[model samples]
Target: MNMLIFKRFSLTILILGTLVACKETNKNPQKKISETITSETQNDFLGNYVAKEYHQRTEGYDWISVAVRNKGDNTIGISVRSRADKKRPTCTFDSKAFKVNDSLYRACSNGVGILFSFKKDSLKILTEIPEQADALQFYCSGGGNFTGDYGRIEGELDSSQIDPTLFTKTLELQGIGFSVSSFARNNKKILQILPYGLEIDNSAITRTLEGSIADVEIEDLNSDGFPEILVYLSSDGSGSYGDVIGYSVNNGKSISAIYFPPISENDELKKGYMGHDEFSIIETTLAQRFPIYREGDTNANPTGGIRQIEYQLVDGEASRKFVIKNSTDFPEKN
Candidate 1:
């Protein structure tokens, strides 16, 4: 009887121990799977993102690129670059407990500051600092515009002084056909402009530029509440011909190409035909406008010649009566 009781007690203890061991074993796998899922979610957010912020007072647009990566310590590493300035600025923070709320994450260096927040899959940037009372209140929001590929940006220029019904247009040069190729305004419109012709079409919002657009600074020449388009056309891949074109948005929701001089001339200047290469517009004064073009030889050698054409707009039409040609050694001084 004593041996039977001892055996029964041993069996009961053994069963209880086995049950406890099995429970712990099952929990280990569950914990591992939960960790894996979390890791994957973090990686999905680790990539390049494009965001835009609008300045109302100055009527300027700020495009920003952000790179996020997991630091393996329950935190995320962030690197930021300005599309306007083209420099990298970096910051670090604990992302494990971070949440996008009414308040934003602020950072600054070298006279530059950025305030950002992440909401769902998109990021928002605050354009105004808290101290600036007269500053415009702008927020950058993204997502739902593309089919889960590239991001899209929409800029709302706060010109309370201007007509509220007036629309702002953003033009991006796509390529150079016999004329200039362009993808304008959130890739909604594609335009081709030649010496005396124009072609316009719609583009896929998710598509990217098939050809390289010459890197040039776009400026508002006429200050007519619109930004101009500057395109660089390359002759032989060596150098480029400068083509400067002005554009404005009409009430019909269509882009109207404002023909500036040199871009509209039927004849080339004394140096050569306007190559339609890369060019930019200079607004020296409210009354004066000049188109600066980069011209090179067929061998891509700098012919040492740059052309500056003066332009005027009267009654909503462009006039290009002044032509000034100069070499590198004798550029016309402003």
Candidate 2:
């Protein structure tokens, strides 16, 4: 073929390929609320389930959805939301439910308990404990509670109403609950925390996350009955440096922020402290453990020992913070 003819043919093929790719992607431009790219109609309960009450004489309506993550384990993350009038138009209930028995999952927050049972085609959520059911008044207004049945929503729940999230989990202690989630926007990761069933206005917290959430723990560090929420974060990379973002509940009235001082801030603590921090709540104290590296040791091989630092929850001038209570070191295992 001539050069002109050959070039035209090649250009035509390229145009066709681009169109096909664009069509494939843009076919379902609707962004849905999901933790992963799984089957939209999967038989499992890891998809979006929604419920709405519509009647001829209905004034204000309730549109709620229960989004279950596709994690294979029985322990799953859930996000529940309800739309109402301009007064309160947000999540009526948001908590992570843990597997209780063979077929029951329960989430307790702010003295209220919610049981989630999955059916073949829908999800049933309600309060089992009669006493906790009374606490539902704080979550919803107009004499309503989040006790109903929701059917699977195939895929789309008005994507405009839901923000796609990477992960979500919740923990509650002493009637205080925290819902944590991570998402990406503008090429940056963002961490969001939603506290529900509080006496004060349930304000949502959002901040930039340098890494991903490794784990979450809740405990009453101060022994004041109100619990503190700790979010363990691991920086993305081979090093996998760890940190924490914590918050404390305020006398069962509201929530306060908790500060975790960086190890570099203290010369002694910073000694041989090369990330890899693991955090947990032991009794009423916050404990952080890491491998102590010697001068010539590598990140993977620390010849010195394991160092653990215990922190006590103390009141700071601005907010509550974790203070080093004691430091102990142990020899490395053979």
Candidate 3:
């Protein structure tokens, strides 16, 4: 009878041990599922994506790509490329994974970033550009965290868009010492206008004028009949506010820069506002406007006033015709 009791006790102990081990495994299954979800989501998010809405070379990018590189931990790298010229990628935004959802992951740096939703094969961008060093506000009104959606592109990814061949053009200029003279070449024939700087053959120069080339338009802002190369540069600080300068070509090879007064809030004249700059060839003048901001104000609630700083070609140079206070229209010639 004593032997039977001892066997029964041993069996009871074995059963209890098995039950405890199973309970422990069940308790931690959720953690394992979370890690698996992260890995899978990242893998799916790694690929090429293009903009849903059509954008020209002047407005923004035609395609944006996300590259997942193994930097010990997984990293999401984003590059915004231009449609007109291939040598144009805005900036390489490198950041680690921010948050992992069931099917999406977010990675951000500065105030600008992109979110990858794997379930939908879509990318959402939150852009908060900085103001230029010459602007008054820390950030511009038109540049804080605007949302943009993009769709996935199939295949092995268009390597062409990733590594675009930089194009070079030849031109000439006269005024040798002006600030915009940086865009003018005294000798070199091939001119490469890159996002970071201007290069004339092997002699590469960075930040020669303002910053990288944000937008390039061939409109005659100086009303010279011939198309002038209006190169819009990226802002210095953190807003979408960029500076614009014009260059007109003589014959097919000679070119010169269009000089205008500094139209920014930080200007000595204090004529412009603290906002993003927009330029257009309206009629015979260059129409310029920027959203107005007050002291200690956020971009969300600007003063609802727009600063109009129009320019016209006077004596073959861009001259500020008039600086309006809060209206889009420049003062009548009267």
Candidate 4:
């Protein structure tokens, strides 16, 4: 009876030990997963991708490139470079990436979705732009509206792909008294501008657009002594229409981006005006002129006269001063 009792106690001790060991293993499963995730991310998506077509617009050829850099602590960084001006700007932040397929992974930030497809030695990328502001949409509409299909470049990524003379021309145009190399070293990238059409008034079709910088002007839109840089940019990637942006210099150094007011396509008189208007800074107001399209007007005979739209800065926000619809307000042809 003494031996039997001793054997029974031993068996109970063995069972309890096994149960405690299994509980510990279950509690620490996440540690193993965390290690695996970090290892996989590092191996999969860190690299440089260059544009395949190089020219997003029709007239000028500017090579654009994108870089995906790991920021540690599970953060990823994305930057885009325009070879024409050597401007590489930060477009997104704190992006979490997930795998879509064996070769494709997607990461979205700031209303833009970037899909990266990896090959053995290169990467093919696709950029998607959504149509709605509150909902999610992509730019791949079988119409070639979004940019993509770039490959990986050899060596480290930098402004070496940009034309050496681009810096000189940019400084000359902006009237900045600085060396090109110094500016390049200080400013790794410039602001990248993109455009999208807004659907309004139950309009089923919205125009697709690509954007480019048309020209730059300096002015004081807020009546401050310091000049506000005005960027004369064209929407729709073509010279079809123009818009002026008001930017203030920050701390007398970096340029600040001017967030334009939302322009809709169905704003009565302002309908069909975006991407078809020319804007200029007149004193402290932004003056825009676009052809007026009456009801049932066609592109060939949009002969519904023209309209002039003016905007003023109120507390650093763009407010429409007034719109003048006239029978005649045409400007010189480009």
C-alpha TM-scores of all predictions? 0.30, 0.53, 0.39, 0.34
Q: Tens-digit lDDT track for model 2 on 121-231?
A: 677776655444556666556776667788886655665444356556666666678888887899999999999867885799999999877667778888887888899
Rank order (by lDDT, best first) = 2, 4, 3, 1
The collision pairs in model 4 are 88-189, 129-139, 130-137, 210-237
All candidates in order of TM-score, best leading: 2, 3, 4, 1
Indicate the worst ten consecutive residues by lDDT in candidate 3: 172-181
Alpha-carbon shift of residue 215 in model 1 (angstroms): 6.0
In model 2, the runs with Cα more than 4 Å from the true position are: 1-164
Off by over 4 Å in 3: 1-209, 221-225, 251-253, 264-272, 316-334
Which residue pairs come into collision in candidate 1?
174-182, 232-278, 233-277, 233-278, 241-277, 241-278, 242-277, 242-278, 242-279
Model 1, runs deviating above 4 Å: 1-212, 215-236, 249-255, 261-270, 273-278, 284-298, 316-334
For model 3, name the residue pairs that clash. Answer: 129-238, 129-239, 130-238, 130-239, 131-238, 131-239, 172-255, 195-212
Stretch of 10 with least lDDT, candidate 4: 165-174
lDDT of each: 0.33, 0.67, 0.41, 0.42
List the RMSD of every prediction in angstroms: 27.2, 18.1, 25.4, 27.0
lDDT of 3 by residue, 111-151 (tens): 22234445456665532122211121112232222235667
Model 2 residue 170 distance off true place after TM-score fit, in angstroms? 1.3
Candidate 1 lDDT by residue in tens digits, 1-334: 2333423433344334323323422322211212212213444455555543422224444344445554322234444333332222121111111212232233321112333444345554432233321121111122111101123233322223222111122223222112233444563434443321123432212222333343322334444543344443333243334443344333213344554444444344434433434232334211111223345444433333334344443224353222333322223222
lDDT-wise, the better of 1 and 3 is 3
**Model 4 scores what on Cα lDDT?**
0.42
